[model samples]
Target: MSERLSSRSLPVEWAPKVDPRELSIGIVHLGLGAFHRAHQAVFTEHAAAITGESRWGISGVSQRSASVREQLAPQDGLYSVLTRGLDSPSVQVIGSMREVLTAPEDPAAVVARIADPAVTLVTLTVTEKGYRAVAGGGLDLADPEIQADLAGRPPRTVVGQLAAGLVRRAETGAGPLTILSCDNLVANGPFLRRLMEDYAAALVSVPEARVEAVSSRQRLAEQLESTRFPAGMVDRIVPATTDADREEAARLLGVRDEALVVAEPFIQWVIEDDFAGARPAWERAGAVLTDDVAPWEQAKLRMLNATHSMLAYLGGLRGYETIAEAVRDAELAELAGELMTRDVVPTLTPPDGLDLTAYGASVLERFANPALKHRTAQVAMDGSVKLPVRLLGTVRDRLEAGAEPRVASLAVAGWMVYVAAGRDVNGRELPLDDPQAARLREAAASAGPGPAGLVDAMLSIESVFDKELAADKLFRSLLIEGVGSLQSH
Candidate 1:
């Protein structure tokens, strides 16, 4: 029988701290996936260790299922993060998470924990769809989950759950708290705040609802005023853990750990310095706390994420499965460099001291890390939700400046072909894992298998393109040309 990873078996030399018995849950994190475990939880563990702030333990809630709880609870929320490098792997046992709760099983418990006065900071990594936010930074009440939430039903979405939690907090006289959004969207904090405000306002205005369960308009307004939503930029390449990774962890730790997370050696978190209450000493763990995170946010989104999407689409079309495999192609590497320098750079104004050129080069180097096995299909999963912030902003800026965004247009065209065919050039059935996949597929099918018609149909998508971009003759022509090149390839 294999040994199990727990407090009893964890080696002392691995720098483990805050035994599970002594940890006090002070932060509540939603979406307890691999990325959160590898990135935020690791940082929190280090912060607690450095400052002896054992109270900052995380109560991780898995939004959809009980899988994470099953993996972690038996281990007492202890897991090893394998930092895979080209030469060797470094392993650290993370102990910042004290409890795991599955939302579908016990959402009320999750809300109560969030409402608890001790829980001053709530962080989320639920992807952009979790926000259910519209273009102008307000809750999309039209969403079925949001509509159900508005009807005073049991909360379903993250926005509904957070709003419900805040209402309970106000009712119980819990003080202010901070909500940190660790997703990749630009200005994520303010954006989430707007959605929360909109959700709360809807609750206050609904007459048939339980008046006492929901906060009054004025009370909700005060809560909104007191609460802080700080935007954050988090970067770490954490591939989905494989069975081989689990076996490796078992060999290294002398125990079989179901909750093992694997990631690259590089990790960075740039968070806005605004907070409503006590926070972890994250800066001690190499996180950058800044008054403004906009520049960094923009840099990562356009420079890293945009190029990542570009490569995912184009690379998959060329039968490359992993990011490293794609970037290894000399032609694709040169295309990435050109896209970053010529297209993405002009659209960005880097912060006072940040060198855009060097940063872009480093980003490419990180992508080329062969150890991580970052799958192109994984990055390509949510194109519809990602494109606006990642690639479309640069497209708009370039067009406004009278410069044709050739590389950016190619990325968009690549996506258009990708969604249309639903299969890579290698005949592998691609996973169309986007929220808007159905509509996108329908639009492509309606265009009838030709690149020109499909490009036209995709460019007309209002959600991805604004009216000006959809109507610009020059932009549409470049997109057509780009799609033609992909077809010819």
Candidate 2:
């Protein structure tokens, strides 16, 4: 066997007798990252294992660069998922992926794979920023990459790739496809549908359309209209694997696994049952298939995701290295609990059968998993985009109800202090790695001194805050006080 982990190097007992080479790629995943590898891919593999299906193979597309491709290509798309629960660590070899493609390196190959008649479902987990949508909503047509794709170049963005592939599928009369979004957005499926519609509208409105362009635009719109964009809720604590994790995995398997992903033992996927065609028997593998995934999506987003961001910002500002450590701080933990119990829970009508109290407790327990080593910095990155998705909804709801979201405001205040001061309480440099970092930093610096001007400045940013939210007297007062307290810390 080679030094690296591959089919030959993997423990034969960990897999079914089915050979990897015989499977066909039926699903094309847009973002080939740790979460999808640990969550959806694992579910797909287990589903196929139960049914002995060979056509449920995954062809993962690393949208940004070739790093993931480089890691998995040599290993026959086999990677070990190191589940870091509270107990001892365990490793398992997964063979759900048949191949990994770098979209940037070969965009045409990606489109062609998606166009395959055999493929019926396309899943995405490209994070919030990947959508390239504007601050409020809709596609950012002015984006250079989106503009380039519109100019007949290879589609580079996630939407562009899907658009091009859908056009091809429509032109070739490929059967209906399901485009499921596993991201943390609200009503992910319908939200994705809106994004696609926006893209299709942009394409259809391309001025002075040539005969060929007109044909392509019409086909793109038709295909997207027919495609299923089912909303989904995915939950798992997939931490970025570190050298220590790889070392432990190598020791466990007796072979180096370069493409390792670390995750918690707990995983839950709530998918709306609206696929256009056949899909994996994911329900057989513990996924909840319901007529309404909204309840589940809301519960996860407002409760779990909102708390995750709060811990990230407040914890990162406190100089904690990992989420586990951050949550270990007694005061921060209380605030996080309050944010869920006192604030976020009120805004959510939890999906049926989900006890919001127990769910919130379980969420904190998951966040406190010491073995997972979920970094505060990693979670805290891209706050400018993350804030709206995670925290602001509850803030909005609370504001409308004439209630003061004191704890929620503190979380937002933590973010401002984290960004404005650019250092932990210990004076360690806190990295402000946001898409709107320059403008945010400028807002902080330009707003004179003290928390009053700083809070006003941060709230004034159009991309991150709704004008109404910024103008609210209660929200402003709370933010100023929260910022002042955090600064004093």
TM-score of each: 0.97, 0.98
lDDT tens digits by residue: candidate 2, 1-489 = 327888877776655335678789999999999999999999998898888989999999998879998899889888889998878899888888898989989999999999999999999999998998887777888889888887778889988898899999987898889999999888878877887888777775666445666788789878876899888999999989999999988888888989999999999999999999999999999999999998888888888888898899899888899999988999999998999999988888877788999999999999999998899989998989888988898899999998999999999998988888888878899888887889999998888678998998999898999899999999999999999998887
Minimal lDDT window, size 10, model 1: 209-218
What TM-score does candidate 1 get on C-alpha atoms?
0.97
lDDT of predicted model 1:
0.87
Residue 466 Cα positional deviation in candidate 2, in Å, after optimal superposition: 1.0
Highest lDDT against the true fold, candidate: 2
Q: Rate the local accuracy (lDDT) of all candidates.
A: 0.87, 0.88
* Candidate 1 off by > 4 Å: 204-207, 210-216
> How far off is residue 346 in model 1, in Å?
1.3
Any idea what lDDT model 2 has?
Answer: 0.88
